[model samples]
Target: MNSIVNKSLRRLYLLGKTVRWGMRPCPAGARETRLIAGAQRSGTNLVMDILERSWEADVYHESDPRAFQVYRMRPLPIIQELRKRSRAKCFILKALCESQDLPELMEQLAPAKAVWVLRNYNDVVNSMVISFPRTHEDLQRIAQDRKLGGWRTEGMSEQTYRLVSGLVKRHGDALTNASASALQWYFRNVLYFEKGFYQHPDIKLLRYEDLVTQPQRTVSGLFEFFGLPYHPWVHGMVFSSSLRKRPAPELLPEVAELCEKLWQRFQELEKPQSI
Candidate 1:
């Protein structure tokens, strides 16, 4: 199929870029490690793809085995070694799964900075239900505290766990995939507030809507945060077609109310630094 061929060609092109960038001479002085963190389906991929197009930075996607294992980021020591070896001035890494540990990770990887992206709950839930059919089932276990072992439940504050558990108890198995995915969004994103990220100077907040609608301004602000100069190649890599493209899914009344409150909170917190 043409789609498959196109995907293959894209991978080859990216590989060529990575290989060529890796061989460049290391710039003088220390290299800054930049991290991209967010909940799944929250435009992290788009951001990473655009960043990868930059010749001044070296990217280590979560799928990169050198920095990740089974899509989760590898240990800090391994990441440090990779940072040390990269020749670029900025060593960029994507760590969505390890978002909960970012505060500590940033401390350990000092001279590091991060961007935590936020997206609309309705859109994120829509994408989750379609891309991950088993999400509802997985979240049921997470809500009931039956599966505390997975990354979904990791670093979950007791207060957050109780809130999600109570919601599941109220609706029982009657909860729809949309609502479940929304709760997943809540639990993961609430960590931004619960972990005191609002006070963290090195971690910046970015909105998915802003990045898509105003790509140049938003990304220029992001690059400024990372202390990297913006390049023109990233312009063609982002488009606004995905903005509010999907119909909002049917969510339970309680879940909808909960997500709206959290969404409003993010809006308030993100106002001052709007690009």
Candidate 2:
């Protein structure tokens, strides 16, 4: 009970802080406000690093502890305000918005631009499974969303519990050492965003290979897409940066084939005429 009470208090405090910060009036960013969004194990960070160095923009990554870039740490309004006020020619930021959350995030933050990075499916899923194995923490996040400190049991209906439990039973195999969840996750987030968010006028897509092999041309196009000046120094930064590192599990051949098909579709979708 004490633990539950503490969580409640924390939520209230966060809500209060958000409300306070949001009430103040601030202008939206004049330069393009970008959300560097992609799959968890994809090359979002690598892309952000290159862009940050090349454009010399005010770049914020998932590592920003003070702001909690993954969740609502300093509130969306606060981040938007800071982005507008920053001295950089373009202010770039990122958050983890996958599946259904993408549209809601765009509606709230209303970024003028977005960069979606894609990686090979097998590599992405393998890396995700290795880096983020299934755990109790995953369910705890759902409980937090429910405004409860614990999961499925404390203040949850049996039906709700059953629903969640079914999902885990269907996907979770922590004991099996297989990554069914990662497979589903890849399809869900990748296809969902590609079908929904890619249609948005402000969004841009880039393949991981393109960014690494043809860094100058790809980044120059990104800058042009966002209406920012292409800098000569960006080439140096790209050359200096490292390339993709795949995670442990031997990639499945079937997954690789599916991923290639998706990549081809992605290329087809990227044509300016499609948008």
Candidate 3:
């Protein structure tokens, strides 16, 4: 009885908390701002850091609960509220691709610009395999524990082995699979580009590889794109060598091969001829 009551109380508390955060207002002067949406691990965080460091831009990190909640409400209201609160001449919101409702959110913030960043599919998968090995393991373990899923969910002792095998077999895959993950990334980029955001007179597409290979050129282009003053600090903030270093064991050749296939597909998509 006590445990049941505790669970009920916790559920009610969570419900109230969600409602409170969900209904919060956008900051004043933030309407009609720029949005940066892309796949996870695609340098979105790096871009956000650079933008935030700029004195002229009021850049919000993923901290705003309202950013996500606004989509649940009518899009226009959130846009109006955001514009009312943003103090900078331009506001930028960054969200991951899996954040699903971003297309609708972008439409609401229309007349706004966008920067879509992408990395090589293999590199992305390699990064994920390294960054969240436990996630791969958990999925397999859960599947086996539940006894209702496919082979990928079968008994798995180590996450790394499971991920490699899963990727090779392409079985009961989750976000951890390089091909699926890469396809998802490609889809997100395609969705916005197809929506005509790239040619919307305000939007621009950026590649993660370019940002790293030509930091100055990319940053300069972005500054020019937004009509913001270019500063030396922005360059310093753009490329963080420490941030890009891989900390985990290297992914095996089989995993790398899968990622390469995804990368090839992305290449075929033809990035905007010029940002």
- TM-scores, each model vs. reference: 0.91, 0.64, 0.60
Tens-digit lDDT string for candidate 1 (1-275): 99899789778876776677667656646777888987999999888888876767788888889999998988788888888777777888897889999978877776789999999999999899888787777867776664653888888899988888888877877888888899999999999889987778788889999998888889988888888779766767688888778788889998999999999998887554433
lDDT score, residue 181, model 2? 32
Per-residue lDDT tens digits of candidate 3, residues 94-152?
Answer: 75532334456566665466666777654665566555445455444544453432322
**Model 2 root mean square deviation, Cα atoms:** 11.1
Among all candidates shown, the one with the greatest lDDT: 1
* TM-score of candidate 1 on Cα atoms, chains taken together: 0.91
lDDT by candidate, in order shown: 0.83, 0.56, 0.56
lDDT of 2 at 75: 70
1 or 3, which is superior by lDDT?
1
Which 10 consecutive residues of model 1 have the lowest summed lDDT?
A: 266-275
| Model 2, runs deviating above 4 Å | 1-29, 54-56, 69-73, 98-111, 135-178, 184-188, 191-195, 235-264, 273-275
Candidate 2: lDDT of 135?
31
Better of 2 and 3 by TM-score: 2
